[model samples]
Target: MRTVKDAWMMVQSEYRGNKLKLVWASLFSIFYMGYIAFFVGIMMNEIVQSNEGHMAVDIMLLSITPLMGFVLNRSAFKYWSEDSYTRMLVYFKSLPIPATVILCKRKIMSVIAFSINGTLCFGLIYAFSKNMRAEMDLGDYIAFTITWIGYGLIVTGLYITFELLFSGKIYLVLTLAVLIVAFGVAFLVQMGGGNLFLYTILCSQEWGLLSPLMWGTLLVGMASVQVFSKWTIHRLKSRDLL
Candidate 1:
């Protein structure tokens, strides 16, 4: 109980420090997502009027916002892992805390933060589209928003682990290079012969497969948080902090 309480306090402190930053980030993302949605609505109108082009554009536009948001959150998490908060994490884990308790607090905080951002983004898009008569309904939008939050958490956790792995300057260059290549691969897959947009759209369908993917990602993220907490505690035990 004490450990859990401590973990909660730690989470609260972190959130309090970043509350303003979170609010601004949420606002920025909401506007950015709204802009993307507006652009998509225009393109959709053009395609409909011209009676040409595949439905892939629609898919790409819809999925791009979430994908971009997820990656941004991951990058942010990586950045934060290098900050003082992570050093504090080492200390926190060294205490009598059950690793899972700390892990849960972090995950819960992440979900709450990401969910707020996702909700704002969705709200902006919905408000902007009030006059456009878009085909999307409330239930579908809510489900997609949840999926976005889940995927963001998973990606953020993975990035946090990598940040720990490459804490030094030497590995930072390698990390950037790898991320560049990853983005290039994604671009090639989508613009090359692959129809990634179509797949994204299919996954967004009412009976789509995104739910399973989201749940699987959440489980994987939880496991990763546990592993990382253990490894971090072990690493800290080997080093002395004056």
Candidate 2:
């Protein structure tokens, strides 16, 4: 059996050897970050400046980063799914290493990727938030920043769990549909004077409500990721190559 160090090498070597993949993966994330910077940060900043009553626009801009973070997380797990036709995963399965170990490594990788993506997303928003922050208290700014990062990490874990057990089509369909429906429901909440976006909640001084839901759902979603990891290992073991 290979040592943990050997398994680490196996994974890292694949990444190091594939420079093009490394570049493509990076560009993929850069694309999303750039989109948020221009469309969300710049355009939305202008919108808020001109149309101050549109809380929904600001809220929607805040939500996209975490949703993109979720997309980044899903990409981490996609290679392991049967749909990707990626050979490294197949190679890993044939080795003597434990599947649980492999799962752990992948989870670590996902967390690192999520953190980097979260930081970039945060930085972009913070840049745009400069003028807005001038009006808000320090404590609220801190809370808002933490809440944004917390939501990004939580949403990423949720999607990683989804990718583990479901087919690509199922993952894609359910994910898009659910996010669409969530915003739809959120719109109603906005219309009814009970905004569901965290940015709105915090700005409205309703962090009491948003805090529990954010932390509570995040705790539960993280737990689900652990369960999904073990379940995915069992699935890989039982699944036939043919």
Candidate 2, residues 116-208, lDDT tens digits: the string is 666566566556755544544545544554555555555555565555455566667767775775567567666776534434335424563
Quote each prediction's TM-score: 0.59, 0.68
lDDT of 1 by residue, 84-193 (tens): 44454556656755555655565555555456556655566555544323544665555544555554554555444444444434335654664565566556665665
What Cα-based lDDT does every candidate model obtain? 0.52, 0.57
Candidate 2 lDDT at 161 equals 51
* Cα RMSD for predicted model 2: 5.0
lDDT of 2 at 173: 77
Residue-pair clashes per prediction, in order, are: 0, 0
